[model samples]
Target: MTWSSMLLLAVTVERVGELWFARRNTKALLSKGGREIGKEHYSLIVALHTLWLSSLWVVAWNVRVHPIWLGVFVCLQALRFWTLATLGKRWTTRIIVVPGETLVAAGPYRFIRHPNYLVVIGEIAVFPLCLGQPLHALVFSIANALVLTVRIKTENAALSGSRHV
Candidate 1:
Protein backbone atom coordinates (compact mmCIF):
# COMPACT_ATOMS: atom_id res chain seq x y z
CA MET A 1 0.00 0.00 0.00
CA THR A 2 1.10 3.56 -0.57
CA TRP A 3 1.74 5.80 2.42
CA SER A 4 -1.53 7.66 1.84
CA SER A 5 -3.45 4.42 1.67
CA MET A 6 -1.85 3.16 4.86
CA LEU A 7 -2.51 6.41 6.63
CA LEU A 8 -6.13 6.45 5.51
CA LEU A 9 -6.52 2.88 6.71
CA ALA A 10 -5.18 3.86 10.10
CA VAL A 11 -7.50 6.84 10.27
CA THR A 12 -10.44 4.70 9.20
CA VAL A 13 -9.75 2.22 11.94
CA GLU A 14 -9.39 4.96 14.50
CA ARG A 15 -12.67 6.52 13.43
CA VAL A 16 -14.54 3.23 13.58
CA GLY A 17 -13.15 2.53 17.02
CA GLU A 18 -14.23 5.96 18.13
CA LEU A 19 -17.73 5.33 16.83
CA TRP A 20 -17.91 2.16 18.86
CA PHE A 21 -16.71 3.94 21.96
CA ALA A 22 -19.04 6.87 21.43
CA ARG A 23 -21.99 4.56 20.90
CA ARG A 24 -21.28 2.75 24.12
CA ASN A 25 -20.96 5.98 26.00
CA THR A 26 -24.10 7.37 24.44
CA LYS A 27 -26.03 4.30 25.43
CA ALA A 28 -24.76 4.50 29.00
CA LEU A 29 -25.58 8.15 29.24
CA LEU A 30 -29.09 7.61 27.92
CA SER A 31 -29.64 4.84 30.40
CA LYS A 32 -28.63 7.26 33.10
CA GLY A 33 -31.24 9.81 31.95
CA GLY A 34 -29.04 11.82 29.66
CA ARG A 35 -30.76 13.84 26.95
CA GLU A 36 -29.53 13.90 23.39
CA ILE A 37 -29.77 17.27 21.73
CA GLY A 38 -29.99 17.97 18.02
CA LYS A 39 -30.60 14.40 16.96
CA GLU A 40 -31.63 15.70 13.56
CA HIS A 41 -28.15 16.83 12.66
CA TYR A 42 -26.31 13.76 13.87
CA SER A 43 -26.79 11.74 10.71
CA LEU A 44 -25.61 14.57 8.50
CA ILE A 45 -22.52 14.91 10.63
CA VAL A 46 -21.89 11.20 10.24
CA ALA A 47 -22.41 11.32 6.52
CA LEU A 48 -20.05 14.24 6.12
CA HIS A 49 -17.29 12.58 8.07
CA THR A 50 -17.83 9.31 6.25
CA LEU A 51 -17.59 11.03 2.90
CA TRP A 52 -14.58 13.03 4.00
CA LEU A 53 -12.67 9.88 4.85
CA SER A 54 -13.92 8.07 1.78
CA SER A 55 -12.83 10.90 -0.45
CA LEU A 56 -9.34 10.80 0.97
CA TRP A 57 -8.85 7.45 -0.70
CA VAL A 58 -10.36 8.53 -3.99
CA VAL A 59 -8.66 11.92 -4.05
CA ALA A 60 -5.28 10.91 -2.70
CA TRP A 61 -4.65 7.29 -3.54
CA ASN A 62 -1.37 7.95 -5.32
CA VAL A 63 -0.30 11.00 -3.43
CA ARG A 64 2.84 10.83 -1.34
CA VAL A 65 2.80 11.82 2.31
CA HIS A 66 3.67 15.40 3.10
CA PRO A 67 5.63 15.29 6.34
CA ILE A 68 4.64 18.73 7.59
CA TRP A 69 0.94 18.06 7.17
CA LEU A 70 1.43 14.68 8.76
CA GLY A 71 3.00 16.43 11.72
CA VAL A 72 0.00 18.72 11.96
CA PHE A 73 -2.34 15.74 11.85
CA VAL A 74 -0.35 14.07 14.63
CA CYS A 75 -0.63 17.14 16.80
CA LEU A 76 -4.36 17.30 16.17
CA GLN A 77 -4.59 13.68 17.22
CA ALA A 78 -2.89 14.55 20.48
CA LEU A 79 -5.43 17.29 21.15
CA ARG A 80 -8.25 14.96 20.19
CA PHE A 81 -6.97 12.35 22.62
CA TRP A 82 -6.53 14.88 25.35
CA THR A 83 -10.08 16.12 24.82
CA LEU A 84 -11.38 12.57 24.91
CA ALA A 85 -9.45 11.62 28.03
CA THR A 86 -10.54 14.70 29.87
CA LEU A 87 -14.16 14.11 28.98
CA GLY A 88 -13.78 10.37 29.74
CA LYS A 89 -17.08 8.49 29.39
CA ARG A 90 -18.83 11.76 28.85
CA TRP A 91 -17.40 12.15 25.40
CA THR A 92 -19.85 11.08 22.74
CA THR A 93 -19.72 12.21 19.15
CA ARG A 94 -23.29 13.40 19.69
CA ILE A 95 -24.40 16.17 21.97
CA ILE A 96 -25.70 13.95 24.76
CA VAL A 97 -25.98 15.89 27.94
CA VAL A 98 -26.07 14.20 31.32
CA PRO A 99 -28.46 16.08 33.49
CA GLY A 100 -27.02 17.87 36.51
CA GLU A 101 -23.48 17.47 35.23
CA THR A 102 -21.44 20.61 35.08
CA LEU A 103 -19.34 21.70 32.16
CA VAL A 104 -15.87 20.28 31.68
CA ALA A 105 -13.29 22.98 32.22
CA ALA A 106 -10.07 21.05 32.25
CA GLY A 107 -7.51 20.04 29.67
CA PRO A 108 -8.26 21.41 26.19
CA TYR A 109 -11.66 22.60 27.33
CA ARG A 110 -9.94 24.91 29.75
CA PHE A 111 -8.43 26.87 26.91
CA ILE A 112 -11.19 26.73 24.33
CA ARG A 113 -14.95 26.47 24.20
CA HIS A 114 -14.79 23.70 21.60
CA PRO A 115 -11.37 22.22 21.20
CA ASN A 116 -12.68 19.13 19.44
CA TYR A 117 -14.24 21.19 16.67
CA LEU A 118 -11.01 23.06 16.11
CA VAL A 119 -9.11 19.79 15.89
CA VAL A 120 -11.70 18.41 13.49
CA ILE A 121 -11.60 21.51 11.32
CA GLY A 122 -7.83 21.24 11.18
CA GLU A 123 -8.03 17.57 10.26
CA ILE A 124 -10.54 18.15 7.48
CA ALA A 125 -8.42 20.86 5.94
CA VAL A 126 -4.95 19.57 6.70
CA PHE A 127 -5.42 15.92 5.72
CA PRO A 128 -6.43 16.79 2.20
CA LEU A 129 -3.59 19.27 1.96
CA CYS A 130 -1.29 16.45 3.06
CA LEU A 131 -2.17 14.76 -0.21
CA GLY A 132 -1.71 18.04 -2.10
CA GLN A 133 -5.45 18.13 -2.65
CA PRO A 134 -6.27 21.58 -1.49
CA LEU A 135 -9.53 21.63 -3.43
CA HIS A 136 -10.89 18.67 -1.53
CA ALA A 137 -9.76 20.29 1.69
CA LEU A 138 -11.45 23.52 0.79
CA VAL A 139 -14.74 21.86 -0.08
CA PHE A 140 -14.90 19.74 3.04
CA SER A 141 -13.65 22.48 5.29
CA ILE A 142 -16.41 24.79 4.10
CA ALA A 143 -19.02 22.10 4.56
CA ASN A 144 -17.67 21.27 7.99
CA ALA A 145 -17.77 24.90 8.94
CA LEU A 146 -21.40 25.15 7.93
CA VAL A 147 -22.28 22.04 9.84
CA LEU A 148 -20.39 23.27 12.87
CA THR A 149 -22.17 26.58 12.86
CA VAL A 150 -25.47 24.79 13.31
CA ARG A 151 -23.97 22.28 15.71
CA ILE A 152 -22.45 24.95 17.90
CA LYS A 153 -25.70 26.81 18.07
CA THR A 154 -27.65 23.68 18.94
CA GLU A 155 -25.17 22.66 21.62
CA ASN A 156 -25.09 26.10 23.13
CA ALA A 157 -28.87 26.24 23.26
CA ALA A 158 -29.03 22.85 24.90
CA LEU A 159 -26.46 23.78 27.48
CA SER A 160 -28.14 27.03 28.19
CA GLY A 161 -31.50 25.39 28.59
CA SER A 162 -30.08 22.89 31.05
CA ARG A 163 -28.05 25.59 32.75
CA HIS A 164 -25.01 23.38 32.42
CA VAL A 165 -21.75 24.48 30.89
Candidate 2:
Protein backbone atom coordinates (compact mmCIF):
# COMPACT_ATOMS: atom_id res chain seq x y z
CA MET A 1 0.00 0.00 0.00
CA THR A 2 1.05 3.58 -0.56
CA TRP A 3 1.97 5.87 2.31
CA SER A 4 -1.30 7.71 1.80
CA SER A 5 -3.23 4.47 2.16
CA MET A 6 -1.24 3.53 5.25
CA LEU A 7 -1.81 6.95 6.75
CA LEU A 8 -5.50 6.68 6.14
CA LEU A 9 -5.56 3.26 7.76
CA ALA A 10 -3.66 4.58 10.76
CA VAL A 11 -6.10 7.43 11.11
CA THR A 12 -9.03 5.05 11.01
CA VAL A 13 -7.43 3.01 13.76
CA GLU A 14 -6.77 6.07 15.87
CA ARG A 15 -10.32 7.23 15.40
CA VAL A 16 -11.62 3.87 16.56
CA GLY A 17 -9.39 3.95 19.61
CA GLU A 18 -10.48 7.45 20.47
CA LEU A 19 -14.10 6.46 20.18
CA TRP A 20 -13.53 3.49 22.46
CA PHE A 21 -11.99 5.75 25.07
CA ALA A 22 -14.72 8.30 24.66
CA ARG A 23 -17.36 5.63 25.10
CA ARG A 24 -15.92 4.63 28.43
CA ASN A 25 -15.79 8.22 29.56
CA THR A 26 -19.29 8.85 28.29
CA LYS A 27 -20.64 5.90 30.21
CA ALA A 28 -19.04 7.15 33.38
CA LEU A 29 -20.42 10.64 32.79
CA LEU A 30 -23.88 9.31 32.13
CA SER A 31 -23.76 7.34 35.34
CA LYS A 32 -22.98 10.65 37.03
CA GLY A 33 -25.96 12.39 35.43
CA GLY A 34 -24.59 13.65 32.14
CA ARG A 35 -27.35 14.48 29.70
CA GLU A 36 -27.31 14.46 25.93
CA ILE A 37 -29.04 17.25 24.09
CA GLY A 38 -29.53 17.86 20.38
CA LYS A 39 -30.20 14.28 19.45
CA GLU A 40 -31.36 15.27 15.98
CA HIS A 41 -28.25 17.29 15.35
CA TYR A 42 -26.11 14.44 16.58
CA SER A 43 -27.77 12.16 14.06
CA LEU A 44 -26.96 14.66 11.37
CA ILE A 45 -23.35 14.59 12.53
CA VAL A 46 -23.29 10.82 11.95
CA ALA A 47 -24.72 11.17 8.47
CA LEU A 48 -22.28 13.87 7.48
CA HIS A 49 -19.30 11.96 8.80
CA THR A 50 -20.42 8.89 6.88
CA LEU A 51 -20.55 10.94 3.72
CA TRP A 52 -17.13 12.41 4.44
CA LEU A 53 -15.56 8.99 4.88
CA SER A 54 -17.27 7.63 1.80
CA SER A 55 -16.04 10.51 -0.28
CA LEU A 56 -12.53 10.11 1.06
CA TRP A 57 -12.49 6.42 0.18
CA VAL A 58 -13.93 7.01 -3.26
CA VAL A 59 -11.34 9.64 -4.04
CA ALA A 60 -8.51 7.61 -2.63
CA TRP A 61 -9.38 4.61 -4.76
CA ASN A 62 -10.19 6.46 -7.98
CA VAL A 63 -7.54 9.22 -8.16
CA ARG A 64 -3.79 9.34 -8.39
CA VAL A 65 -2.10 9.98 -5.05
CA HIS A 66 0.84 12.38 -5.08
CA PRO A 67 3.85 12.16 -2.74
CA ILE A 68 3.88 15.78 -1.56
CA TRP A 69 0.15 15.66 -1.08
CA LEU A 70 0.51 12.40 0.83
CA GLY A 71 3.07 14.03 3.09
CA VAL A 72 0.66 16.88 3.74
CA PHE A 73 -2.05 14.35 4.43
CA VAL A 74 0.14 12.68 7.07
CA CYS A 75 0.82 16.04 8.68
CA LEU A 76 -2.87 16.77 8.85
CA GLN A 77 -3.43 13.35 10.40
CA ALA A 78 -0.86 14.20 13.05
CA LEU A 79 -2.75 17.37 13.78
CA ARG A 80 -5.85 15.29 14.24
CA PHE A 81 -4.00 13.13 16.73
CA TRP A 82 -2.93 16.29 18.53
CA THR A 83 -6.50 17.46 18.76
CA LEU A 84 -7.64 14.11 20.13
CA ALA A 85 -4.79 13.94 22.61
CA THR A 86 -5.47 17.48 23.76
CA LEU A 87 -9.10 16.73 24.40
CA GLY A 88 -8.39 13.38 26.06
CA LYS A 89 -11.44 11.92 27.65
CA ARG A 90 -13.48 15.03 27.03
CA TRP A 91 -13.43 14.51 23.28
CA THR A 92 -16.59 13.04 21.88
CA THR A 93 -18.44 12.76 18.56
CA ARG A 94 -21.71 13.71 20.16
CA ILE A 95 -23.03 16.82 21.85
CA ILE A 96 -23.28 15.64 25.42
CA VAL A 97 -23.43 17.81 28.50
CA VAL A 98 -22.11 16.34 31.68
CA PRO A 99 -24.00 17.93 34.51
CA GLY A 100 -21.98 20.39 36.59
CA GLU A 101 -18.95 19.88 34.39
CA THR A 102 -16.64 22.83 33.91
CA LEU A 103 -15.46 24.03 30.55
CA VAL A 104 -12.08 22.72 29.50
CA ALA A 105 -9.50 25.44 28.95
CA ALA A 106 -6.28 23.54 28.79
CA GLY A 107 -4.26 22.15 25.87
CA PRO A 108 -5.55 23.15 22.43
CA TYR A 109 -8.62 24.52 24.18
CA ARG A 110 -6.33 27.25 25.44
CA PHE A 111 -5.60 28.46 21.92
CA ILE A 112 -8.92 27.83 20.22
CA ARG A 113 -12.37 26.92 21.46
CA HIS A 114 -12.79 24.24 18.79
CA PRO A 115 -9.50 22.84 17.62
CA ASN A 116 -11.17 19.51 16.88
CA TYR A 117 -13.36 21.12 14.30
CA LEU A 118 -10.31 22.79 12.86
CA VAL A 119 -8.81 19.32 12.41
CA VAL A 120 -11.98 18.23 10.71
CA ILE A 121 -11.80 21.22 8.39
CA GLY A 122 -8.23 20.39 7.46
CA GLU A 123 -8.95 16.70 6.84
CA ILE A 124 -11.85 17.48 4.55
CA ALA A 125 -9.36 19.10 2.21
CA VAL A 126 -6.17 17.21 2.92
CA PHE A 127 -7.48 13.73 2.22
CA PRO A 128 -9.11 14.44 -1.12
CA LEU A 129 -6.35 16.77 -2.24
CA CYS A 130 -3.82 14.06 -1.53
CA LEU A 131 -5.59 11.94 -4.12
CA GLY A 132 -5.78 14.84 -6.61
CA GLN A 133 -9.48 15.26 -6.06
CA PRO A 134 -9.82 18.94 -5.37
CA LEU A 135 -13.42 18.88 -6.46
CA HIS A 136 -14.25 16.31 -3.79
CA ALA A 137 -12.41 18.44 -1.28
CA LEU A 138 -14.27 21.55 -2.33
CA VAL A 139 -17.70 19.97 -2.31
CA PHE A 140 -17.36 18.20 1.04
CA SER A 141 -15.48 21.08 2.59
CA ILE A 142 -18.49 23.29 2.02
CA ALA A 143 -20.91 20.70 3.41
CA ASN A 144 -18.69 20.04 6.42
CA ALA A 145 -18.38 23.78 7.03
CA LEU A 146 -22.11 24.20 7.06
CA VAL A 147 -22.60 21.36 9.51
CA LEU A 148 -19.79 22.60 11.74
CA THR A 149 -21.24 26.11 11.79
CA VAL A 150 -24.51 24.78 13.13
CA ARG A 151 -22.73 22.45 15.55
CA ILE A 152 -20.54 25.25 16.91
CA LYS A 153 -23.49 27.52 17.46
CA THR A 154 -25.46 24.87 19.28
CA GLU A 155 -22.51 23.68 21.33
CA ASN A 156 -21.50 27.20 22.33
CA ALA A 157 -25.03 27.97 23.37
CA ALA A 158 -25.07 24.82 25.46
CA LEU A 159 -21.76 25.73 27.02
CA SER A 160 -22.97 29.23 27.82
CA GLY A 161 -25.96 27.89 29.69
CA SER A 162 -23.86 25.41 31.63
CA ARG A 163 -22.17 26.25 34.91
CA HIS A 164 -18.99 25.89 32.94
CA VAL A 165 -18.10 28.09 29.90
Candidate 3:
Protein backbone atom coordinates (compact mmCIF):
# COMPACT_ATOMS: atom_id res chain seq x y z
CA MET A 1 0.00 0.00 0.00
CA THR A 2 1.12 3.52 -0.71
CA TRP A 3 1.66 6.06 2.05
CA SER A 4 -1.69 7.67 1.35
CA SER A 5 -3.31 4.27 1.47
CA MET A 6 -1.66 3.51 4.77
CA LEU A 7 -2.85 6.80 6.20
CA LEU A 8 -6.34 6.06 4.98
CA LEU A 9 -6.18 2.64 6.59
CA ALA A 10 -5.17 4.19 9.88
CA VAL A 11 -8.04 6.66 9.60
CA THR A 12 -10.44 3.85 8.79
CA VAL A 13 -9.35 1.99 11.89
CA GLU A 14 -9.75 5.09 14.01
CA ARG A 15 -13.23 5.66 12.65
CA VAL A 16 -14.27 2.07 13.41
CA GLY A 17 -12.99 2.47 16.93
CA GLU A 18 -14.98 5.68 17.31
CA LEU A 19 -18.10 3.92 16.11
CA TRP A 20 -17.63 1.24 18.72
CA PHE A 21 -17.18 3.84 21.44
CA ALA A 22 -20.19 5.80 20.25
CA ARG A 23 -22.32 2.67 20.26
CA ARG A 24 -21.39 1.92 23.83
CA ASN A 25 -22.15 5.50 24.86
CA THR A 26 -25.43 5.47 22.96
CA LYS A 27 -26.55 2.34 24.78
CA ALA A 28 -25.63 3.82 28.12
CA LEU A 29 -27.43 7.07 27.39
CA LEU A 30 -30.58 5.27 26.32
CA SER A 31 -30.51 3.14 29.43
CA LYS A 32 -30.38 6.31 31.48
CA GLY A 33 -33.61 7.62 29.92
CA GLY A 34 -31.96 9.73 27.28
CA ARG A 35 -34.32 9.74 24.32
CA GLU A 36 -32.90 10.15 20.85
CA ILE A 37 -34.12 12.91 18.60
CA GLY A 38 -34.00 13.17 14.82
CA LYS A 39 -33.69 9.49 14.21
CA GLU A 40 -34.86 9.80 10.62
CA HIS A 41 -31.83 11.71 9.40
CA TYR A 42 -29.23 9.67 11.25
CA SER A 43 -28.83 7.16 8.45
CA LEU A 44 -28.09 9.89 5.96
CA ILE A 45 -25.28 11.18 8.16
CA VAL A 46 -23.82 7.68 8.43
CA ALA A 47 -24.08 7.04 4.71
CA LEU A 48 -22.44 10.34 3.89
CA HIS A 49 -19.48 9.68 6.14
CA THR A 50 -19.13 6.10 4.93
CA LEU A 51 -19.19 7.18 1.30
CA TRP A 52 -16.79 10.03 1.94
CA LEU A 53 -14.21 7.77 3.52
CA SER A 54 -14.76 5.00 0.97
CA SER A 55 -14.38 7.38 -1.96
CA LEU A 56 -11.10 8.68 -0.58
CA TRP A 57 -9.76 5.16 -0.43
CA VAL A 58 -10.67 4.61 -4.07
CA VAL A 59 -9.49 7.93 -5.50
CA ALA A 60 -6.61 8.92 -3.21
CA TRP A 61 -4.91 5.58 -2.83
CA ASN A 62 -2.07 6.46 -5.19
CA VAL A 63 -1.86 10.16 -4.40
CA ARG A 64 0.92 11.76 -2.39
CA VAL A 65 0.16 13.23 0.99
CA HIS A 66 0.44 16.97 1.52
CA PRO A 67 2.45 17.76 4.61
CA ILE A 68 0.77 21.04 5.52
CA TRP A 69 -2.69 19.69 4.97
CA LEU A 70 -1.82 16.63 7.00
CA GLY A 71 -0.72 18.93 9.77
CA VAL A 72 -4.08 20.68 9.65
CA PHE A 73 -5.79 17.31 9.78
CA VAL A 74 -3.75 16.44 12.84
CA CYS A 75 -4.84 19.65 14.52
CA LEU A 76 -8.43 18.82 13.74
CA GLN A 77 -7.98 15.43 15.37
CA ALA A 78 -6.69 17.13 18.48
CA LEU A 79 -9.81 19.28 18.57
CA ARG A 80 -11.89 16.16 17.96
CA PHE A 81 -10.31 14.40 20.90
CA TRP A 82 -10.91 17.44 23.07
CA THR A 83 -14.55 17.57 22.11
CA LEU A 84 -14.98 13.88 22.81
CA ALA A 85 -13.16 14.09 26.09
CA THR A 86 -15.27 17.04 27.20
CA LEU A 87 -18.45 15.15 26.52
CA GLY A 88 -17.04 11.97 27.99
CA LYS A 89 -19.67 9.24 28.35
CA ARG A 90 -22.32 11.61 27.07
CA TRP A 91 -20.78 11.63 23.64
CA THR A 92 -22.72 9.55 21.15
CA THR A 93 -23.13 9.67 17.37
CA ARG A 94 -26.80 10.50 17.79
CA ILE A 95 -28.50 13.32 19.64
CA ILE A 96 -29.65 11.82 22.88
CA VAL A 97 -30.48 14.33 25.56
CA VAL A 98 -30.86 13.12 29.06
CA PRO A 99 -33.61 15.13 30.76
CA GLY A 100 -32.64 17.41 33.61
CA GLU A 101 -29.04 17.30 32.49
CA THR A 102 -27.28 20.59 31.87
CA LEU A 103 -25.47 21.11 28.62
CA VAL A 104 -21.71 20.82 28.96
CA ALA A 105 -20.13 24.24 29.12
CA ALA A 106 -16.55 23.13 29.64
CA GLY A 107 -13.71 22.76 27.13
CA PRO A 108 -14.57 23.56 23.50
CA TYR A 109 -18.21 23.64 24.42
CA ARG A 110 -17.44 26.81 26.32
CA PHE A 111 -16.84 28.56 23.03
CA ILE A 112 -18.88 26.72 20.40
CA ARG A 113 -22.35 25.36 20.78
CA HIS A 114 -21.47 22.52 18.42
CA PRO A 115 -17.77 21.94 18.55
CA ASN A 116 -18.03 18.34 17.35
CA TYR A 117 -19.85 19.39 14.20
CA LEU A 118 -17.21 22.02 13.52
CA VAL A 119 -14.49 19.40 13.81
CA VAL A 120 -16.43 17.11 11.49
CA ILE A 121 -16.86 19.90 8.96
CA GLY A 122 -13.13 20.44 8.92
CA GLU A 123 -12.44 16.73 8.64
CA ILE A 124 -14.83 16.23 5.76
CA ALA A 125 -12.84 18.71 3.74
CA VAL A 126 -9.34 18.49 5.10
CA PHE A 127 -9.00 14.72 4.99
CA PRO A 128 -9.22 14.72 1.20
CA LEU A 129 -6.96 17.74 0.80
CA CYS A 130 -4.35 16.13 3.01
CA LEU A 131 -4.41 13.18 0.65
CA GLY A 132 -3.90 15.52 -2.34
CA GLN A 133 -7.52 15.28 -3.47
CA PRO A 134 -8.94 18.79 -3.40
CA LEU A 135 -11.87 17.96 -5.64
CA HIS A 136 -12.85 15.15 -3.37
CA ALA A 137 -12.59 17.53 -0.47
CA LEU A 138 -14.92 20.04 -2.10
CA VAL A 139 -17.54 17.47 -3.06
CA PHE A 140 -17.74 15.83 0.34
CA SER A 141 -17.64 19.19 2.10
CA ILE A 142 -20.74 20.32 0.25
CA ALA A 143 -22.54 17.06 1.00
CA ASN A 144 -21.61 17.30 4.64
CA ALA A 145 -22.88 20.87 4.86
CA LEU A 146 -26.27 19.86 3.54
CA VAL A 147 -26.56 17.03 6.02
CA LEU A 148 -25.33 19.14 8.90
CA THR A 149 -27.90 21.83 8.18
CA VAL A 150 -30.67 19.43 9.09
CA ARG A 151 -28.68 17.85 11.89
CA ILE A 152 -27.85 21.06 13.71
CA LYS A 153 -31.43 22.23 13.57
CA THR A 154 -32.61 18.95 15.05
CA GLU A 155 -30.01 19.08 17.76
CA ASN A 156 -30.86 22.63 18.69
CA ALA A 157 -34.53 21.83 18.93
CA ALA A 158 -33.84 18.78 21.04
CA LEU A 159 -31.79 20.74 23.54
CA SER A 160 -33.90 23.86 23.51
CA GLY A 161 -36.05 22.81 26.43
CA SER A 162 -33.15 21.50 28.45
CA ARG A 163 -30.98 23.51 30.82
CA HIS A 164 -28.71 26.17 29.41
CA VAL A 165 -25.08 25.53 28.61
Using TM-score, give the best candidate's number: 3
Candidates in order have lDDT scores of 0.91, 0.75, 0.94
Candidate 2, residues 78-139, lDDT tens digits: the string is: 76778778667767777778777888777777888888888788888877787778888898
Question: Which residue window of length 10 is worst by lDDT in model 1?
Answer: 156-165
| Cα lDDT for residue 138, candidate 2 | 90
Sorted by TM-score (best first), the order is 3, 1, 2
Which one wins on lDDT? 3
| Candidate 3 TM-score to native | 0.97
Which one wins by TM-score: 1 or 2? Answer: 1
Name every residue pair that clashes in candidate 2. Answer: none
Question: Candidate 2 at 50: error in angstroms?
Answer: 1.5
- Would you list the clashing residue pairs of candidate 1? none
lDDT of 3 by residue, 1-165 (tens): 788999999999989999999999999999999999999999999999999999888888888999999999999999999999999999999999998899899999889899999999999999999988888889989999999999999999999988866
Cα-lDDT of candidate 3: 0.94
